[model samples]
Target chain A: AQSVTQPDIHITVSEGASLELRCNYSYGATPYLFWYVQSPGQGLQLLLKYFSGDTLVQGIKGFEAEFKRSQSSFNLRKPSVHWSDAAEYFCAVGHFNKFYFGSGTKLNVKP
Target chain B: DTAVSQTPKYLVTQMGNDKSIKCEQNLGHDTMYWYKQDSKKFLKIMFSYNNKELIINETVPNRFSPKSPDKAHLNLHINSLELGDSAVYFCASSQRTSGSIGEQFFGPGTRLTVL
Candidate 1:
């Protein structure tokens, strides 16, 4: 069974600090990787995606994710955290016509 | 213009009632999907329709039926809605081509509250 796991259920970072959210997936082959952010009472917005080529992918709102095949991990990172960045982050793996999403990681930005 | 849109942004209904959530995408994608987000904010894929054809159906209750009238529209109907069904439902669309299903465009979710 292919599945996605986000070990960190919640993370807190101070404003202007670096942030990293971990994600791991179990798949037979390299799969499409994605990162999405959802704010309170709002729809999810795609942050970045990794299909092929360039292992490093940049996404909207100053977010970037790197796909490491050996580790079977796609971790999301940001240089500096903003108060506005406080939200739920989800890591997803896409295969064929379906997608498997991780439970989610909630980020709380402190002042 | 919204690429993907869902009707009834907020729905408050009683248990055992049947309701439908409509979805439409103008991005010209051939694949559409239905996702459910629980109160814990866990997102799960429910169904996927490509060009009005069912392609993927996850482990969901039979009470949850999805209808795709056309490539651009996918609707989800729930029968005997239970309190456990209260959650946010999202509609999404993507293009599947050459073994690459790109990123999905999501609509503003419909928050369903069954009492």
Candidate 2:
């Protein structure tokens, strides 16, 4: 019933270029959405979350995401790509203390 | 200090062997959870406990058993390990109150390798 989809399996971008990772969710009610980044062989770190209020949410490591209720999408964006930003990104939807995660998108940055 | 900690960052064992992974959270949260991450990095929730009471249990193999000694400690024991059991296991905690399931804090994760 509730699910998350990250369409991009892999993305590559040159340094200083803009980056966008797409995500979409399927839920009955307003979803508690989150973005997490996982480095190679590391645990996931929370990037940001969208609960209520302003649609644009800022996160650590210079990442930001916007929640669009009409489209059921919460896409992550970055003004400039960094070499260190190359990692796996996941989008999750939480409800009643449970989370539904997407397949994840792997980002590759070329210097 | 680590907010959530798991013992044995890496484990390697043969098939049919029994092993256990211990997890502890010092964040004083009310809820704890265990998640399994496959080689493809797909995270699936295994079990969850709130104040030592089982609250959520996903469709996991019976070979996997979770025990909570107290509110802060949760241990996962697996019997008769198989190659398919080899994956990274993560323990996370969150403070859920008044129907608000807040953000989760995860441990470093334990990488298990079964031969």
Q: Give the alpha carbon lDDT tens digit for every residue of B1-115 in model 2.
A: 8899999899999999999999999999989999999999999999999999999899999999999999999999999999999999999999896786788888889999999
User: What are the TM-scores, per candidate, against the unseen true structure?
Assistant: 0.97, 0.98
lDDT digits (tens) for residues A1-111 of candidate 2: 899999999999999999999999999998899999999888889999998899999999999999999999999999999999999999999898798899999999999
Off by over 4 Å in 2: none
Q: What is the DockQ of each candidate?
A: 0.78, 0.75
Every model: iRMSD: 1.0, 0.8
Q: Point to the candidate with the largest DockQ.
A: 1
TM-score of chain B of 2: 0.98
Candidate 1, residues B1-115, lDDT tens digits: the string is: 8889999999999999999999999999999999999988888999999889998899999999999999999999999999999999999999998966889989999999999
RMSD of each: 0.9, 0.8
* Candidate 1 regions with alpha-carbon error over 4 angstroms: none
How many backbone collisions does model 2 have? 0
